[model samples]
Target: MEQLIQAIILGIIEGLTEFLPVSSTGHLILAGEWLGFVGESSKTFKIVIQLGAVLAVLVLYWSRFVSLAKDMLAWRFFRKGHLDALHIALALLPAVVLGFLLHGLIKQHLFGPEPVLYSLVAGGILMIIAERTKRRVTAEEMDDLSYRQALGIGCFQCLALWPGFSRSGSTISGGLLLGTSQKAAAEFTFIISVPIMLGASLLDLYESRDVLSSSDLPVFLVGLAASFIVAMLAVVTFINLIKRLRLTWFALYRFVLAAVFYFFVLM
Candidate 1:
């Protein structure tokens, strides 16, 4: 019962932070550390439950995904003002290659609170700097993103390899630096996240299969369910928030959270 409750709590944390500029992995590591849930199996559980958040994206963007699929099948790469499959593929390639090369190193060294703390602070500063240095909004819509812009965003995503430097945060900041509108940047961040997270979750699950047990099935299910429900809400709310608010608010939150972690967890 206690374990199940812990799973639910972590699931909520995961859902709330996963899509936001605040790093979900960073939150999870801090939460797990404080809650006494840090372990190999727990790490695997975190990875597995993120699939629920991924599903939220699929549910919300089902139509877009369907359109993209159809466009690919028909080879109508540029029929209308929509992003082609090539754009997404190119955006994803950098992360795929870099992630493969650094996966082991990151898992071995950086999946802890100390590294996360540093990344949280650095990412927060980067976000603030990006937001303050505003540029003209060139890419006003997701469809307007060029292949070069996509590749650039993908390169920025490489920073997220360091936990606490959020994937969405890095990419959105990248898009902003490249003159993508706030809403467009947020949308693109969410769209590209589907493939990257799904692949990473599957890979983690496969590597950590040995740690999973039949007894942990219920915990996993509960976590997945909770995360899915909450993630749907978080994603929608975040999209709306980005439209009306500045990214600096999230950056401030990250800065404060990093300080709290340093005082409470590190010191």
Candidate 2:
């Protein structure tokens, strides 16, 4: 009974942080450390709950996602629609490969409080650097994106493999570096999430096959419910927040988390 309540609380935190560029894995690690959910199965539970948030993105962006597919098929405007989607796919390929290769290590060691602390600080520093550079807003819409640039951004995103670095954070920074508008980068980041989260969840479920079972199904369901609802809300709020707020705020958060982690873990 006690475990169930704790799991629900973790679910709420996972769902809200998963979508924003705030490093869901980092938060989960910190939460797990604080709540004594440091075991292997409990850690995986944090990741598996992301499946729920994945579905939320699927449902919320269904119309646009489908349109991207349909437009790609129609080969409109010389197949720019299809080509752009292909570019996104290309960008995701690196993480797909690296993620599977590092799956076990990431699950066991990367999500630990120590690593997460440093990752938070490093990621925060990178965000500040990216923010200070400049905002060019070169690509107004998806159609304006290029394959070469997409490939470049995709390569840049590979850096997020560290626990607290956040896939969205790396990708959005990639887009910003390549001169994408804030809204466009955010929109693309969210859209790109469908594939990335689906891939990660699938990999996690596969690796955790022996431990996962019907007995634990109820908890997974509850976590899913929490994650999906809060994720949708986070998505809505995050998009609005990105436009109005500066990246420095998130950077500050990372620095603060780093300091907190250092004090708690080292001292």
Candidate 3:
């Protein structure tokens, strides 16, 4: 019963923080520590629930994805109207390659409170700087992005491998600094998250297959379901809210969270 409650809490945390500039990984680490849920299985469970969040993106942007799929299937995805496929790939490439190379090292050394705390503080600073130094909005929509801009965002995404830095935060801030409008940057961020997070989740599940058991099924199911439902709501709300809410607010929130984490949790 206690474990199920913890699962639900963590699942909600994952959904809420996953797409936000705030880091879901950081929240989960602290939440798990508080709940006494630290273990190999706990880590696996956290990663697996991210799949539910990824599913939310697929559902929310089903038509867009279908269009991209149809274009790819027809071998026309590289044409003028279908550049999103290439853009997404460009935005994902650097992080994917770097993450693959550093995966084991990150899991071994950086998956801890101290690393997360430092990342949270550093990421917040980066977001603030991005906002202040943002250039004129050249890309009004994701489709307007140039390949170089997409790759630039991808390089920023490499920072997210440090756990609490946040993929959305890094990429969106990169977009802002690279001349993409706030809405466009956010749309690109959410869209690109799908493939990267889904792949990572699946990889984690595969590696942890030996430790998983039927007994853990209920907790996993509840967490996944909660994460999916909440993520759907969060994505929609965030999309609508991004226009009015500046990235600075989220950055400030990260600072507060980091301070609290250090004082209350780490102490």
Q: What are the per-residue Cα lDDT tens digits for candidate 2 across 1-267? A: 766777788788877887677798888888877887767677668878888788888888888778778767886424544335677777778878888798788776777888888888777777777777886676866557677667766776677778888767777777777887666667777777788877777778788888877767777778888888888888888889888887779879878877876788657
The alpha-carbon root-mean-square deviation between model 1 and the true structure, to one decimal in Å, is 1.2
The C-alpha RMSD of each candidate to the native structure, in angstroms, is 1.2, 2.2, 1.2
In order, what lDDT does every prediction score?
A: 0.88, 0.77, 0.87
Residue 62 in candidate 3, Cα distance off native in Å? 0.1
Name the TM-score of candidate 1.
Answer: 0.96
After superposition, the stretches of candidate 1 with alpha carbons farther than 4 Å from their true spots are none
What tens-digit string does per-residue lDDT give for candidate 3 at 27-59? 888788888988888988887899889999999
Best by lDDT: 1
Clashes of each: 0, 0, 0
Root mean square deviation (Cα) for candidate 3 = 1.2
Rank candidates, lDDT, best first: 1, 3, 2
Q: Where is the poorest 10-residue window by lDDT in model 2?
A: 76-85
